[model samples]
Target: MKTKIILFLTTVLLSINITDRGSASSNYFEADVIIYGGTSAAVTAAVKVARTGQSVIMVSPDIHLGGLSSGGLGFTDTGNKEVIGGLSREFYQRVYEYYQQDETWQWQDRSEYGNRGQGTTALDEEFGTMWIFEPHIAEQVFEDFINDEGITVLRDEWLDRKDGVVTEDGRIVSFETLSGKRFKGKMFIDATYEGDLMAAAGVSYHVGRESNDTYDEEWNGVQTGVYHHNHFFPPDGPHIDPYVSPGDPSSGIIGGVSVAPPGEKGSGDHRVQAYCFRMCLSDHPDNKVPFPKPDNYEPSQYILLLRLFESGWHERNNFFTKYDEIPNRKTDTNNHGPVSTDYMGMNYDYPEASYERREQIIQEHEDYQKGMMYFLANDPRVPREIQNEVKRWGLAKDEFTDNGNWPHQLYIREARRMIGDFVMTEHEVLGNREVPKSIGMGSYTLDSHNVQRYITPEGYVQNEGDIGVSPDQPYEIAYGSLIPKKDEIQNLLVPVAMSASHIAFGSIRMEPVFMVLGHSAAAAAVLAIREGQAVQDVNYNDLRNDLEADGQVLEYSD
Candidate 1:
């Protein structure tokens, strides 16, 4: 294991192009634009900046690039394909090209696989954009992007948030990573899911749901009475006790249940939505990695699942409903029912926690997920019928090949949202208000995963904070949402954590949308540099013109 890691690290160090031009005095490199995060958005941002004839560097905390897109989220949540017309579409086009070759279909025959994608056509030979794919294929696409564009990428370089970001008069002068490498740039983009770079740059942000009244949005807060997706207990369904000892209040709360009262409906709290890995599982025996018991595995921790299964045994098939099979008989398994992958209420502190603590949380989630899969496959408590079905599937050994066949990134559905010059509210997303200075378009449904799992007042197990509000049509993503206020920061732009209320963010947080915004943010940054203007002061007219020329669908058809 150590040898594999060492060899992989050496290969990565050799493969990536980094400009460590100042090794003597804390290795520093200057660029016209600096991008943080190794997410798909980050890579696309670098590509856009580079194409515009500007020098750019991507300093990533992750060893792998393209974040969740390369990490196991092959089942993309792209809403309207026509609205996706920029670099985001270019990526899918590359996927399409890769799969057209006979070599790309190694695990399965092209004639055998036929899972037409969720939103856009997956293997569309006409459009030449394969929306769904394997994780390794996505990673390869991102690598190809950086290599083809000649964009420098510094992998595994974590930003030192505390003392590394040096700001002067609302502009980021330079930033240093924990490894003592420094980067100076005219513009910076935070494309990380965590919004770490934006927060470190003294950007004001929100981490949890705001009150419904705060934004006049119906799906903003507590949502005690509302259920959007089928991730909650049916109100009329039979009661499932949320305690280890049934109906005993004195007994401690169950593993997944919170003791606190779900606050008033539409009220605010500090709880964030649940996160999980968009796991890649395969039924092919030769390319399978059986679920392994994590080092910190505790059998008793999954007792709640036993109860859930016991209560809903008749719905056994429903448990496997979310196994969205991609090419090669591999599945992009996601959280479906109320008791699926999401570890509810366990990730509240992750947004602001230290890296070590965040890692611990991530490991705990990984263990819980893996252990649950193992339990279903072998536990006596689980029905033999379900066990037989689950046992047929295992990790896709061909994917995430380096990390024990585990996903390289966690599915961070929600995190810190920057409070920029314009906060995109539900009004704008739902097409009630006009979005001025359009930069990109978002059409995905407002889909938020469960935020908290708690015992209902009626003694039934319930998961709150799962919302799914569809937009009226594709809405424009405002340019102001990506940049800080004029008085706060002038050079930094945040595409991933752009200003939005919780409900609005739900629709805008899709991978394809992130890439679109990433492309837009870079275009704006390049224009700002050419004009010697702050990001906040970039001319919307000229910026819009450039974005349209670059194939960004900033507005839907009139």
Candidate 2:
């Protein structure tokens, strides 16, 4: 009995931390392709490789797979669904399967739930697949793909950046994790949004927006006046005052406003776009967890929101959230209007920060967002109408329940973009240049969230780095954009953070497109391995043929 008790405890402890990379455990793994990051693309790439009868493993820092796809970004940002093929389309097709069942609509009646979508295609029902989904459902689909494909995924395994990478002769020999586990592969695919593995492998990359002159693109850099979206200038006349003391200039710029002058129109800067959780909120009373004031919540931090209200910009500026509804009465509530969920200028250090520092930033964002919810719902200063409306909604109890019903992943819109051999510019996204060696297609408008808040020259507050430019059609992404230069890294392929300018990346950074590129990247990797060639040396003709065989829409024949 004594020995059995000890055995049970040992088993329990081992099971509890089997996947924890923080522990001092050791192992070695080898695969045909080593894909880092458990993003939507990561899983799809693994699925593609597995489908092609190759061994692949995804080593991700995230315990939860499907970076933003399952990370409360259920309302997918697919532009042209027609162009989304291969493994990318298969994932959405599964979402439709999950929702078509009567048992899937737990909180809401199917007949009562109205269909919704935006321009061109109706996301609710597009013949074969459904676009809008609950967070839990999206996650389940990704998990199901893993189970069915028998893909190996090591969760919570962070890359060892300092000395973890082992490179030889411009090729990655192996990469170690924080947990001391080493992964070696014939070819590597960096599917992370942060581009950690890509950067660690000595790949040339860019951290911030490039000068328009660098890429000869018009919308690449500083534009203080562009207001393509319904932010900054509210429907009401004069913009919100940016001073802490309202009209007093000596009071210093308000907490959220940047003092730096908007740089030259086409000059480069180290500013990144704002990020916020696509909170899975719900109005369903049975599944709603009322917003709890965070441990570090401070009402004073939201003084800018109060100022907006006092300035008569409340109703017109989405005082609460842009609660885009999904299936089962849940919402993919994102930052809407100025002074919403996005905490601008606070996350400029996130992309390259230490893990601890990034954690701090993530916590700060959570607290600020939670504070906003609590303030709007209970603050006496809030208008009764706005307060009442906010009170009706809360975090979805069924989603991310283990994490206090909060989103497990922050929406990292853009991070380290690789500067590969052939950089994707506005010319390719806008269909100006004849793109060659097509891998996938991107059709979304060049949309970027706000990067900084600064006092305008006219003494009113304005936001910069929010520009929206539409593309002509589903543009083909070049294969050259996915590979590092032969001299830097010969065996690496980057799909998520592939070569692209900031403005051009805005159009190509959709989740579906990532999955498409994931499929292409894996296809290229498998071919490269079979032919005994470097990733950069893979024959584009053979790669394109394989991608097309797998139903990837490389080119749109209009």
Candidate 3:
């Protein structure tokens, strides 16, 4: 009787088409190309594929489209504008178009704004069209790409890195998301700054700076001799005391000093540059979100900033410069003076941490930054005039409104980089050497923010690793940088993780460069699919011809 009952239940389950209890049958969604990330590169890659009449899907973890470009980073860092072409140029052109409309400037008049939208001399005539822009305008362009190209975008769907289902043939058969949705594609482009997909695919990548010996390059790690940016106290100014203990060893070093042994000058260490929220602040009272004290606010955290102010180190020049005549009193305030909001040396573990731990770190940074602002504005210790100046500005309400009026995106300047076939070193960037098979070009200054905050031996705080070296001329970005070493991953292209040294990547990592590389990578991916070859095996001559025909610049000029 029991056997019959069990058999009856099994028969009923089968009849109901229930294969496994509480588990839905696995399914796949198909696309010719899949671009992972919501960055400028992801947009360009998807648009390029769609323009070629191929089906493409962009899977982004962001609710918004453009990464930093649309996320309150209005001031663009376009290196060599000439190297920007194809869809990348089209993006800037679209920004120009958006500004041309009289209605676009409801907050400010068009005549008063002048030609600030035209950008600087760095713009390439054949390709460039106004690089600097507002956040909303950038978002509009990305939205236009999606609407016009018919590209499918899955926003807020994060990739499931572990056990994400890559077939044995080395092709990414399908990638499952955290929510159990599967994205199946023939070719994949890892356009994220974090290189999450590339790491998940088991591709080899490097996170910290490679030691000087490892790369045999001059600038790699432990660069104590190099102080490119003016982070230290000016030589002319009265030297600020660096510690709570005067000449005593017990008080500990002032903030922003390296605690570790300087390490091998050229050896690799687990340190990526700094990260900050590119705050869009406004003086307009009606549109400003007044600074609020963070929940975990602590007065002691900002002692260094207070000390700097106490020593008369007051200058607002550290705030990023703006293009002339842009409407709306909004400033793209970046990480300024030491101890001013950038949680230096605290983000080292973020790239590799679990989601829960990353959240904690993000919260910690948020608190540290928010508290810094509040301290500047309301702390009794601050100078009255400085506090008044800070009070004049607040978060832009016209910008990101979802996260309590905070910018939706965190500025993750750099993260895990794929150590692919071609590692673009400083020699390739400084015109000391050239890379073969150019697919794109980057001309921005090799800029790195302070990596560590340590106390100097003199008891004063010192910031290190903020280097800004200009590339005298534009340089070609190697095609090899876009592809993985032939054997690791056959069908993957990493425009964001393109082969480049830390310093070279400092320039190539710019939004404009990423977009250019994205377009090139997509074009190459489509060609590879048609020609039946791995991405590395794609014919360079044919690829170059196609890129040029598509309006990509491969060389740099004055």
Candidate 4:
């Protein structure tokens, strides 16, 4: 009997020990903040939290950082540089530091390189501002932030949306990844462009363009009359013949024109702007990775481009240029001209699709784009000089070598956005109204890439929803946009997919702006944790004070 009792006691003790160890291991992390998404903002937020003496962990799906900032968008779309402040400014400073080294220019000499080396005012690196650069340099800057701030980074850890647990009392008690690794944190931030974690937490969100009637936004959806650029051919000029069949209607509209019924003019639609990989091309013989024919190459895709060239639509040389110091031989080639690059009207279902479906969509876009490039370079229908010029440029050998020299990142310009307490509208963006709880500032032009391609009544192909309206004055971004409705989820904060209409988000989606908001959100989260209140209950005065002290520009004028 004595031996049995001892054995039972030992068994109980061992079980208790095992249980305790499991629980402790599951809840091992106790950081003041945990940021989701590895965007430019995520890096800035992590750095800010560490600077404030709080433990912070950044969980990123991306192996690289800085989103589009370092990805391939070297031409910074800074509206007003004066409004940029704090750690946001510091990031540009680091970009300046990167170019300070003579070794950064192994491909090109200093004399031959143009003014791309002049850094922003904050760092004064004499290198050009932080608007753009090669992908590797951006990655190096993010790596530097991690090393300097001692941030705990877990890369490629996707949140398990279906069963990822969030507690009843409003705290993100624990979240499990696809790999079954659990992470527990006191405060959580949804910093992804898609707002994936926020959605998983049962937070309400809005996808696609809202109707003009819903938000009272003039520029909301199905903007038929608005012509922002020379994307389509004017019938009178040296314009291309707009019809594939001339008089017959069965031949189908050009590739870049919309085929769907144009929904109500002011009503909402499922359409979102197209996305494409901004190919970084080089002309240097030694560095250029020549364009190769994609495996699924199709000649039919380039028919519109060929027709455009034949019709005298000659704006093919509109790719954004960089400074001489940054190697003028290289070009930051983006989606240009009608039927040039943007796979417009094809991404309507991306926001709500399943993960497996999303992967399929991404691949489809890639194959289509790769085939488009191959067609332009090799097809006989292409103008001889245009084909020759296209062949002269190829993918930059130094960029994105992992994916067979294709850009690893996709330009998800806008995705799932939280329909939070205060939805930012064009009224606030155009300076008609002021956002009361200003947490950050955005100065980029109210820009939206073409949302639809349609053939008009005159039989001319047209691209719509490509507005680039400049802000009347530098505007304030509200803190309310970051917080979901108090009744929905009190603890959640969304920096990337914050409350904003589709048109409004076009301005706010800049990479630097995301970083600024990310830092601010982390700061607010830390404050809320310290005060022992929900994020919505945190004192605005205190939050504003901390953000201001940290150099976040809460409000901007002219």
lDDT against the true structure, per candidate, is: 0.88, 0.85, 0.76, 0.76
User: TM-scores of the models, in the given order?
Assistant: 0.95, 0.94, 0.90, 0.90
lDDT of each residue in 1-558, candidate 4, tens digit only: 999998788656644543353465542444667788888888888888888877777888888877777677665666677777777777877777776688877687756755442233222344344555666777788889988876777788888888975666666776777866676667888888778898898888888888988888888877777767655455354544345676566876655566666666878877887788767788888888878777877776666777777766655444223211134356667776666677888788888777788788788788878888788788888777778878887788887878777777778898988899888888899988868888889877777888887666666666677777877788899989989888887777898989999999989898778888888888888898889888888899999999989878888654
Higher-scoring candidate on lDDT, 2 or 4: 2
Which model, 1 or 3, shows the larger TM-score?
1
Candidate number of the best TM-score: 1
Please provide the root mean square deviation of candidate 3 (C-alpha atoms, Å): 7.6
lDDT of 3: 0.76
The TM-score measured for candidate 3 stands at 0.90
Q: Model 1: what TM-score?
A: 0.95
Q: Which runs of model 1 end up more than 4 angstroms from their true locations?
A: 1-26, 313-317
In candidate 4, position 314 carries an lDDT of: 59
Candidate 2: list runs displaced more than 4 Å.
Answer: 1-26, 120-126, 234-236, 317-321
Q: Return the lDDT, model 1, position 427.
A: 93
RMSD, one per candidate, in order: 3.3, 4.0, 7.6, 7.1
Backbone collision tally, model 3: 13
Residue-by-residue lDDT tens digits, candidate 2, 163-201? 999999989999999998998888999999999999988
Best by lDDT: 1
lDDT order of candidates, top first:
1, 2, 3, 4
**Which scores greater on lDDT, model 2 or model 3?**
2
